[model samples]
Target chain A: MAKLKNPRGLEDSQVMKMSYWKILSILLLVYTVTGGFLMEVPRLAIVNETIRSLYFHVPMWFGMVVMFLTSTLYAVRYLKKPGAYFDIISVEFANTGLIFGFLGIVTGMIWANYTWGTPWHGDPKQNGAAVALLIYCAYFVLRGSLENSEQRARLSAVYNIFAFAAMIPLIFIIPRLTSSMHPGSGGNPGFNTYDLDRNMRMVFYPAVIGWILLGVWIATVRIRLRNIEDKILELEYEKNH
Target chain B: MKRIISIAASLGITFTGYAQEPEMADGMRSEGKIYVVVAILAVILFGLVAYLISIDRKVTKLEQRLNDGKPR
Candidate 1:
């Protein structure tokens, strides 16, 4: 609340425009690092030490899903309004989502290497996640192939929406339907069943929020960079003509 | 010595939980092993923040190039 007012007492509308992602992400990073490990966890068999991986690994998937959802929302808007701004936002969100998704896979593999005995076991969730990311990867390839900006935006927007739709079943539904080595799959109970203690929830929730905010902040930065690049290109075109 | 035995017992590696002490992930907590993980994490986090800062600097340079360094 105190940050609402300008420190210089100048009448600047930039006050409301600036985001708090930078500061909050740093704070939450500190909170997650210290609190995540120090807190008590449910003493379950096989996943005793690796339960802490829940804080780091699960948040990546959560952040990726949230960022991809945001990307799809913008893609829909681009289809409706047909604006370059929306396209840029959509692409940046996807880019950030890819980073989170990639990190999710890496962390999951590391966790799995210890818990599941293999990095790339044919778990339904793992296979599903891989397919979802592959779909998103094709979206980027689609964008790069097109030369005309408007056509690229239109086509990519459509593809992005479809990718997000398909990813839902891959990530959430199919994992639950078939057997999975991961928790909360097939007949196994979810962590919530054991986490009635709520010891991990305190840090886990904050970790999710923090990672999502960090993704948004990175996307925002990329969007601004895109805008700058667009402006510079426009200026060069004018000078050449 | 005794701690490993208790941990092994508690995790049902040798015996069961009732026969041993409470199960805690003493892997990172003991013998300053936690500090190694802490250091690795700190370095990774620092590297990411540094990368972000570099991006911020690049953006600032671009803004200055586009706007002649004047406030918009």
Candidate 2:
């Protein structure tokens, strides 16, 4: 039996061992079981009511933040290494991050509609998130418009770094300056004191971990698929030439 | 055309009647629209889950093909 070589020169066994999805599935299973049990308990109903969205929404934001941070790291590494693999990883992570970001927005809107008056109030947090999303959207558009791979990677990396730097102030800092209907508003305590209790933390922490792992898992799968597609395209081009 | 006009005329009168003194029940009726919104969102969520499952299967097939060294 012969082993196939990965394009990056890693062995097939190594690739098989790198299954983030399997780990994520296990984490998700644990979360579902625990969350279900927690919801059923009558004593924690008050804590669980509004905080339930925290499990879904906070995890999404955590995943998005992690993805963007990881992509930034990869972008920097790509600039240093000048490799296609890093570029692919960065791009795939960005794409996955955007998916989670969009989910976060949807979940936040639904929660807000129930808690606030409207689905979308002109809140600073909402506007900041929208801007951050648009910046990432432009990053993809910039990549699409570029003809050369190296140029695309370079320009996109630069843009990724800038967008991420801007995102920090937009999503986190600037939102803190304004009066927001959402939690963690101006001069208000955030996720501290009475906001998050022990019971809520139990599920909330795990939810963050589970969702971040899931995001990474999804990004890894996307990266693998993209790598394969690139290899196939290269092979076809070689054959044609 | 005349029948359509009469129907429109009657609807217009009915709307004017309600518009003059929009009853408190109309508030409840508008609030009921939230249920419709929730239902639509539920349907969308179901559709998204279904689509995601399909995508997962496709990805599995693609991965298997890649492992087998088949062109796709």
Clashing pairs in 1: none
Model 2 chain A weakest 10-residue run by lDDT: A40-49
Q: Tell me the tens digit of each residue's lDDT in model 1 across A1-241.
A: 4444344343234322334677688678768877887777766555666788888999899999999999999999999999888999999999999999999999999888876679999899999999999999999999999999999999999999999999999988898787676776664445544345587888888888988888888888899899898887887898799
lDDT, residue A241, candidate 2: 100
- Candidate 2 regions with alpha-carbon error over 4 angstroms: A1-21, A29-37, A40-48, A193-195, B1-72
Q: Highest TM-score: which candidate?
A: 1
Error of 2 at A58 (Å): 1.3
- C-alpha RMSD in Å of predicted model 2 compared with the true structure: 12.3
lDDT of 2 by residue, A85-165 (tens): 999999999999999999999998887775554779878889999999999999999999999999999999989999899
Model 1 chain A is weakest, by summed lDDT over 10 consecutive residues, at A8-17
Local accuracy of candidate 2 as per-residue lDDT tens digits, B3-65: 333443455456547553312233433567534544564466456545644555456556667
